[model samples]
Target chain A: MLLQAHSPRGLGSLLLMCALGLYLALVASISLGPMDISFSDSMRALLPKQSFLPSELAPHIEVIIRQVRLPRTLLAIAIGAILALCGTVMQSLFRNPLADPGIIGVSAGASLGAALSIVLFGSLAQHYPEVLLFATVPVCAFIGGALTTVLVYRLGSGPNGTSVTMMLLAGVALSALAGAGLGLLNYYADDQALRDLSLWTMGSLAGASWPGLALAYASLLVLGVLFYRHAKSLNALLLGEAEARHLGVNVQSLKRFCILLTAAGVGICVALSGMIGFVGLIVPHLGRMLCGPNHQRLLPLAALLGALLLLLADMGARTLIAPLDMPVGIVTAILGAPFFIVLLIKQRGRIS
Target chain B: MSIAIQTHQLSVSIGSKQLLKPTSVALQSGQLTVLLGPNGAGKSTLLKAMIGELRASGKVEVFGQTQKSWRSERLARHLAVLPQSSELTFPFSVREVVELGALPLSVSKLQLDDIVDKNLALTDVSHLQLRPYPMLSGGEKQRVHFARVLTQLAQAGEQAILLLDEPTSALDLAHQHNTLKLAKLQAEQGACVVAVIHDLNLAAQYADRILLLERGNLVADGSPWEVLSERRIEAVYGYPITVMPHPRADYPLLVSA
Candidate 1:
């Protein structure tokens, strides 16, 4: 028996430990980079002007910490949390351990939407206002994510309930379709739009702006509260659909709520930071291992762990090659693909 | 006794083939009911329809209230069902799984813990409370779910309705009897308890009432002695069988002849 925690106190302590770890990672993320600023120097730059600490850091260093790294770090935290939160929700909904937004075509559909927005909107860029240009991609991406989720859900569910086999196959098919759509969009995109699309495919925090950061944080807040409240319902769902309904979980509405919010969450993440893969698939599994499968504890722990994992991945993407700046998506895939393979092997029974 | 479940012409059909022909029955509190039938005999279908899981046309009322009128959460307090098998692959501890039953109830934490503890003890799974659900034997997992449903019905008091679908199909011999004994005990406490059981002797011993079905129709409804007559059993099961008084007890004992 892997006796993880014997008491609520123990679990609370474990959550605290993960939070502490996340804090350290956040500090490290803001401190260490290609510019090579000291931890204390970055912290001083972040501290208020009224603080007693003397201002000895260079203006450029302060600018680097405040303008570049701080926004980037914040973006990573929000993106990672939303990704992990959405992943946990999708896995519970599908009842498949391996379901992740990136692996299951939700991210790909959102990417397709983003591509269409760029290519179509680019042609009339001069006519449209800057605000509309900024809003179109995320709105379109959200619609795309929601539509794909509904289509996959319809294909997978029947009178008996959800067929994991059908759901996964549908995901695979949608991913391929989305890929083809992207290829077509690439053919029509202008030079600037094409460059943006290619960078998005790679996934970087290089374009982290203030407005994007606000949107990401707002989504994290909304999704975090909404998802947390339904922790009990999600747990009942794991028992089976009828079992959940028996537990008073109005199963239909719960499924709809989960599908829509998770899609929107994924849409927001994909909009803010291009497809950061595997955080959702990996974080919940780790959370369950650490805290067992109680979503009440798992959701919060997953959010913290997700933020930590992505921040760490982003840190690696920046420093490993130093100045060359590897795409964070590539770094995450390198870390995630092996873990996914191990999970696949572990689930020796029906792959569905 | 009060009627705990009453169905009026409740029927279920697939695209073309009817799985359960229209049937009506009223089950009372203070009686342990067993739905018995052979393969494709609609025993499972009747149970599914009663719980509103299957799309069946007919009026099903519980505690004098129509199924459609009672809110799901409100109904949950009064009714809980144990599925034949759960598809839960998540690594939840046994206690956590049982605790999921109390989701719809507004009981205090102490009351919730008390309910879980009592049911875990009732199902004889108190020792396995900390064990992960997936690592357990199939029977153990079933008992854990049984405990969960029991916990949900705890606060329902006299209005509780418990439905078990082949709950002992996975249990050992000792556990099979133990599970029926628990269901009987629940019936004695005034809850309406129904179980789909295949073991004829076990049903004869524990069930206060028996419902025999064949090909989507109710073939027999009465005491086990009336429902499990040797000729009736032979005709339905397509096997020659003898029904004799048990050497140790007064109820019928079935033997293949």
Candidate 2:
């Protein structure tokens, strides 16, 4: 009988705390990199027009903050938000707390797509940088993600309505098939292409650019609004699919829309950052612990919490080994895996 | 008054097995209809078919409109169903879970609050509204779902169809009686309420009409006294039961003898 009320004030306070946490992480992310720009100077660099100050950071420090760290930070925010939102949606769609983006096979499909593109165009690897990644790779990944989703969806749905169990089993099978595809690609790839593919698989913000950042934000904005609008329907779905339909939700369309939307979101995320995991899987759960599992409150909170966690993880990636960047995925797995295990231990009673 | 739901030769089959045979029936508003049958007697299947949860042959109509003609949201406002079990495992509170039922309606925040609270009270879950749903006992969880369906139908204003499957399978004696009384009350308010229940005594006590099914066929349809005859109950259920008049109540009583 905890917090028997849905008080706006309680939600307002949680949002405030999350916002504060995000701000701190953002500042640390921008200012505490290898160069270690002063907080005030970094703040000034963040300003639209930087004027000379007595204690200004180095001339190139401005470029580092404005061009490099800023875009990477914002990209982290966008990708993290998208991943978390997609994760929450996947869990809701499956009606299970444990389901994540990978459960749908879209992430695997995207990885395969990236590897394929890298191998297909490896001959021009030395000369082709921007077109290879930003254009061809992302498009291929999106197409691949879309194809695999449609395949899984078709395999699961029938006149009896879409079967969650069937979809899950199909996803597992498809993920295994995609893994085999990746293994084959690895065998065939050239050395430079292999390196690129490996880097893509690890997931990073080192390749963050303005256009990609814009694309990520656009996906986040549209996906956020769409997911939030169906918050009530998603809550109804939690009861069970049959119960959901009785509550006026077109359960079939809801599932289809959710699968495709999340696929697009995950595809974009994989395109930009490769294989960032755990943010989506863990942040919604943390949000549910803060607020109840009402998607109205859960989705936005997940987005914010996702952004903050990824920002912190990305910061660790940048600074953990000095100038040599570790994959953001590694830090997330290291951080999230243990925290998730601890959470499971605490929730063992409820889980059982 | 008027027929609220009607099905014409509705049958369901999966592969070669008929889950529900060609069965025709009609249910009216202001009546509590109880479906009685043994295990795999197709009581649940008929309910699922009427609610459009299963792929059924033949035609079903609700409030004079073909079942397929109504949009999902429109039908939801006029119909609500409680399944045998829930797959919900999220950390939602009882109140939050009940609030999910009002998703189909465009009621004001004030009205929604009023509806949710009143249903919670009606279903005897008011005391547990703040409790986390997963922590509740099985009976308590069923009561919570009962309250949710009530909340869903709160704005339906009487001309609604509410189907409940094994609604009291988990409840104790007193709560079981209370739930049936609530279903009867909904029928009194002009809603067409149908329940798939295993207890013959409860069905005789609360239902205005009784439907008996066996092997996916409608075997009997009448008032409790007409349908609860000893020969029919023994034949359909393959068990010995004595039918007798209740000492004081007007309905027939059945005791497994």
Candidate 3:
């Protein structure tokens, strides 16, 4: 008998369904904000065909939909997809279910980098603000993430190869170090810098701009294709490191490539969206549960699921308290923790 | 016959505790060599050293190239190893797990499937092809791994080196023989097959040559009839064991005296 749920055609259909749902979520997010734009009006504003209409007819509805909500919604999708994809890769890399960018200290490292930018370059940022915002935070965040990934990998790996137990423990220790560094930055920050740091740590897509949207989507596209190419190698990896080696995979190079790419992808996401928690942690499991752990299927599917989940979470953050938009990170944690608990319960006897 | 594996003064040590003493031997194709040893007798270590899975002193050459010199992917095409136990972290279907054996080979889709199918049937795991690997019993897992290594060797043609550590340890009576029989067939087909086994009877029945080890040293290496004498068995295994000629075959058979 065919494994019904795991069949490629079945999973393809599920992915198509999620893609449709994501379109619907995108429409809902654009129209459901505090603005008085109707759902039809939002849709028309989004379509290029309707862009020729009179300004009076659509009013500032164009501004509200195109300028305000569109970028934020797109950012949500891009960041969501990026986080989930990185999480899927990280989980496989560590061979542990609990590995996530945020939980494993990559996000915390990024946060520390961002915090340094706000505190150290605060005055310089005011003079040439574009340079600081585009250069300092993203570069430092990428470096921080790359360093932490290498550190964690080095700390966890032994003569027997990488130990999942050691990786998890290293993640915990690094996260703690990041937290203390963040606290120290907080102690020294000016009032405005402190606010920026807090907003970043909590994660918000409210800072979405056209350039940021372009970067996020570009990163997602590149990472998706690159990761897909490594799918078979990743499958062999699931058998065990030694077995993967016997299968002719250059395990060291594969690990290095994955770790570097993921760190860069995760660093960019964190730099743009702040430390959005749980999407990376939860989305991979959700994808694995629906499709099997086959990376070829799981990576793209996880990206779609992550995009859908983040868009929905962003929607909740926007409408949860009306005019005061809650942090999207909060929404993700609320949804993710319960799912994680169920996973833990199911895997209680098996976790090592 | 071409030599498939040659080890010169090869030895493994971890933190100054020697696991395998310096051992020199040449394993030729068309021979099923069984490594028989008691508990902690360094059989697995010696096998790992030969395969370059563990760092060892001296040299290991596969098909004239040093084990360390051949790129892993290139070496993999000519060599395959089945560790004592494979740690399957995911719930991969048995077919998927077996297909991993074809990772080093650039076979077409149909050819890979043919290879997978033939080896799966050969190991009697065709029925479990679609089952998740983690759910299989120990014997089934062992057989699946044997199939994987065999699949790897299938692509290597003749004169490939097949290193198996305890290939039949978890198998039932019939499966144990079936597994060793496959190894014997691989050797007869001109592959260099070296297997680490505990069952003296199984080794005696299947091995074209037997190498006995004790306390990190090679005690005896010869044909089953020559090396499996009562005196040698007692000295190596530290037990009173009687060796008798198999009633139906020319090989020796052992039973506790």
* Number of clashes recorded per candidate: 0, 1, 0
* Candidate 2 structure quality by residue, lDDT tens digits, A1-352: 5544333347778988999999888888888788867888898887766355554457798899988999999999999999999999988886766556665677889878877887886666678785555678777777788787788768865654456567768878988998899888888888877777776667888778898998899999999999999998999888877889889999889988898888888888988888787787789888988888899999989999999989989999999998888999899889777875676576566442
lDDT of 3 by residue, B17-102 (tens): 99899999889999999998899999988998887778889998888888888888877888888877876756677887888888
TM-scores of all models?
0.96, 0.92, 0.94
* Candidate 3 chain B least-lDDT 10 residues: B83-92
* Off by more than 4 A, model 3: A1-8, A47-52, A57-59, A126-129, A157-166
Clashes of 3: 0
DockQ of each: 0.65, 0.62, 0.54
What's the residue-level lDDT of A131 in candidate 1? 78
- Residue A66 lDDT in candidate 2: 84
Model 2, native contacts kept: 0.82
- Better candidate number, 1 or 3, judged by DockQ: 1
- Among these predicted structures, which one has the highest lDDT? 1
How would you order the candidates by DockQ, starting with the best? 1, 2, 3
Model 1, C-alpha of A99: deviation from truth (Å): 0.6
Candidate 2 lDDT over B1-257, as tens digits, reads: 89999999999999999989998899999999999999999999999999787899999999999999999898898899987778787879898988888888889999999999899988888998877888788888888988888888877875788898998898899989988899888899999999999999999999999999999889999999999999999999899999999999999989987
Instruction: Evaluate residue A261 in candidate 1 and report its C-alpha lDDT on the 0 to 100 scale.
Output: 97
